[model samples]
Each structure stands twice: as C-alpha cells, then as structure tokens.
Target: MGVDFSGPEARAALGVVAPFDMELDAELLRWLPDDVDMLMTRTPFVDDVVTVEFAREVADEGVVADGVRSVTAGRAEVVAYACTSGSFVRGRAGQESLLGVMRGAGAGEAVTTSGAIVEALQALGVRRVAVATPYVPTLSHLLDSFLGEYGVSVTGHDGLGLEQRIWEVPYAATAALIRSVDSSEAEAIVVSCTNLPTYDLIAPLEAELGKPIITANQATMWAALRRLGRRPTAPGQALADH
Candidate 1:
C-alpha cells in the first residue's frame, strides 16, 4: 500500500510485491500513515532492460503467490503488482494473468501499475499522451506499444539508459526528464515507473506543463484505494478530484 509519511494519523494496509529498493518504500512512507502495516515481498530483476523474460520472471505465479500469501497470511483485501513496465511489457492479457495469480494468493482485488496508469488516463478523459520514464530503450518502446493496445495514443516518448541503475535515478533528474518532453498534442503526461520518484513533483509539474500528470506510484495508490471502496483526496495536482 502507498501511504503518505506526512499523514501519520491515518493508517491503511496493502500487500506489495516490489524489488528490494528503499527508494520505493521511502516514497510510499512519505504519504503512508505511520501505523499502516504493509505485507511486502521482494521480486528480483536485472535493471535497465525491459524484456519478456524479465516480465515472466516477475509475474511468475509461484513466486507472486508465495509473496502474496506470506503478506496476507489469512486476511484479504487488495494487492498490487507495483511495477509499471514489467506489467505493461507482459501486455494487457499478461497483466490480467498476473492479477489472477494475486487473487489465487488470496487478494480480493488485484491491480498493477500499468493498469492503474491506463485507468488514471481514462478517468481524466485523456486520449493522446506523451510518456517518459527512467527505463531502458526496449522497455520504453514496449510501454508505448502496450498503451496503444488500450487505445491511448502516445505522441512521443524517451527513456534513460540507466539500465539496472534504474533505482539510482535521482528524483531531480526524474522531474527534469519529464519536463523535457514536448507534450504539444498530448492531453496528459505519463511518468511511468513506481520505482522512479515522481510523486512529489506531480502537482507543481502539472501547473507548469498545463496538463494532467500520471505517475505509476500515484496511479497505483489511487487504484488500490478505489478498489477498497475509498476515494483518495487529491494530494497532488494531476488527478486531485477525478
């Protein structure tokens, strides 16, 4: 679950399958309630390149089921596949298959960052979009194709070759990379990647870009809350109300 660290008074629970990176945990902690309990499992991956093999490895049913089962123990609510390109690379059908695994592991509701990004774009009524990410070239192209399948047009896109150093991508660089995109015909900007730190910049960037900004983490959190039958108050500019 993505909880804001600033709002310590409110607690929420979520089960997450993420890589062994503190950056993602740190970002989620910022918005998560202090008392929130998260059941987490680490998924191993080689950074930088987005490949079908990598996608398959992450979405391995046995691995995901084991992780989800460990976290949930017995209680069930919602579970999220926290990777953006990983899920998208697997394509829509692959994503649903992963969700099925999560449900099999005892998740009442299941979602992925890729699915959430699409849902967020649809919720905002955005059709044409420009996508940016701190991923390798292959992954970026895969994301473009994945979105196209959902009927979302990606006008332009770019990716950083930081490869496995994806976790090392700085927050400032992430914001700058997103800002550098020319979103002329795009209705919104999608900063894809939960591991990349883009949440804090969502509001300010939206004001400057004059369009909605959808980040992987933000969309995943919003989708999880919605699945739980709760509406999150807009903390950042992009999808504050909608």
Candidate 2:
C-alpha cells in the first residue's frame, strides 16, 4: 500500500493575505499588495455620523471575521479596516477594542486604517499633523480628539461637511483641502477618509507640499505590510518608504 501524502499539505495556500473592506464600486483591490492573496468584504458605503454611531451595523466584527474565515479558507494574515472616520470616531481605546474583536475572531493580525495612520505618523517621525476629512465638521473634530490620545496632535485640519458625497469629492478639491489645512508647523499632511481615491495623487501632492501626505488607504496598506513584517518600497509613501 502506498502512502500518498497530499491531503492537508496539498491545500493551495495564498500567502500573506490581507483583507480590507470595500463599498460598492470601490477600487480598493487596486490599492493592496499584488503578490499576496488580497480579499474584500463590504462595509456600509455611507460616510455619515449615523454609520459611525451605529458601528456594529457597518464595521461589524462578526461580518469581517466571518468573511475572513470564508475567504482565506482558514485564517488571513491581516484583517484591516478601511474606514478612517468609522474607526477613529470612537477614539483611541475604541480602536484597540475594535482590533481586539478582530483578533478574537481569528485574525492573525488586526489593523485599521485609522490605527495605521497613528503608526505611520509615528514611524515618519511626525508629531504635529495637518488633516482634511470628507465628513462633516463634527466627525473631523472627533478625529482630532482621537489622535490626541496617541500623543499625536492635529495642529491643523478641515472637513468637507459631507454625508454620502465623500466618494464624490474631486481630486482637485482634495488637494485644495490639503493646502487649506496644511501649515509650515505641521510635519505631515493627512488626508483622512478611505472612500476618496488617493494613491494616484500621493506622489504629486507630496512633491507639491514638501511634506508627507498620509491618506487612509495608504496607511491601511502600509500597516498591513508592516504587520506581516514586510518592508516593501512603496513609492511616494513615507511610511512604507521608511
């Protein structure tokens, strides 16, 4: 009798996988690691205070953990939240609690775009930052408070006072937001909110501002890679480039 050893070892494993949330029609996949088995789970697309208040309805841990278990066949290397406002609106302890849920649910590593922004800022050696968000002013102020707990200061910031229109804000307007909030004292410019497309604008904007521009998606992907102990040369991103 021959021992054909191929059962468990034969599984087609997708290595260093990262899972991030995507709303309908989002180009989130294009922003992730190409060499890894990247996957998506939908989060509520609306960028409103209601979505942030009713967190469980949108960034629900159960939905994410279940999706992770389903997609990676067992466990994903990292489960990263793609929403900035939703993750940060709850403040610091809240993010830790949010990641706690992901870890308890079976994630190898837990990260949120908001949490990553903190790490990215620290890693880039920036303490005071300028920020621009697409949410209403209330949400923007909440983000400022969130960063304070981490010892990072939002010396300057603004929001578009938007509801569902965050995704619709033009790149020019986003660039304008950066300029509006940015100051010489701010070591970095953080363009908050994941729904906005930012990667294409990162290089040009950073070049223009002469300071690091950390967007929601940029920090999310950067943190996912760092959690995996990776050091990819992600161009135009100070967090990854470091």
What TM-score would each prediction reach against the true structure?
Answer: 0.86, 0.82
* Candidate 2 segments whose C-alpha is farther than 4 A from its true place: 1-27, 44-51, 54-56, 61-64, 231-233
- Shift of residue 6 alpha carbon in model 2, Å: 14
What's every prediction's RMSD, in angstroms? 5.6, 5.0
lDDT of 1 by residue, 81-136 (tens): 78886688778887778889889888888888899899999999998998898776
lDDT of 2 by residue, 1-242 (tens): 99987764322122121223334223444544555545555543434343456343565656555655554455355777677876777788878887887777666777887898999998898899988887767667888898889998888878887766466678898888888998899999888877787766788888888989988877877788776665544566566676
Give the Å error, residue 108, model 1.
Answer: 0.2
Question: What's the true lDDT of residue 199 in model 2?
Answer: 69
Candidate 1 TM-score, true structure as reference: 0.86
Cα error, residue 77 of model 2, in Å, equals 2.3
Q: Model 1, residue 203: what's the lDDT?
A: 86
Model 2 lowest lDDT segment of ten: 10-19
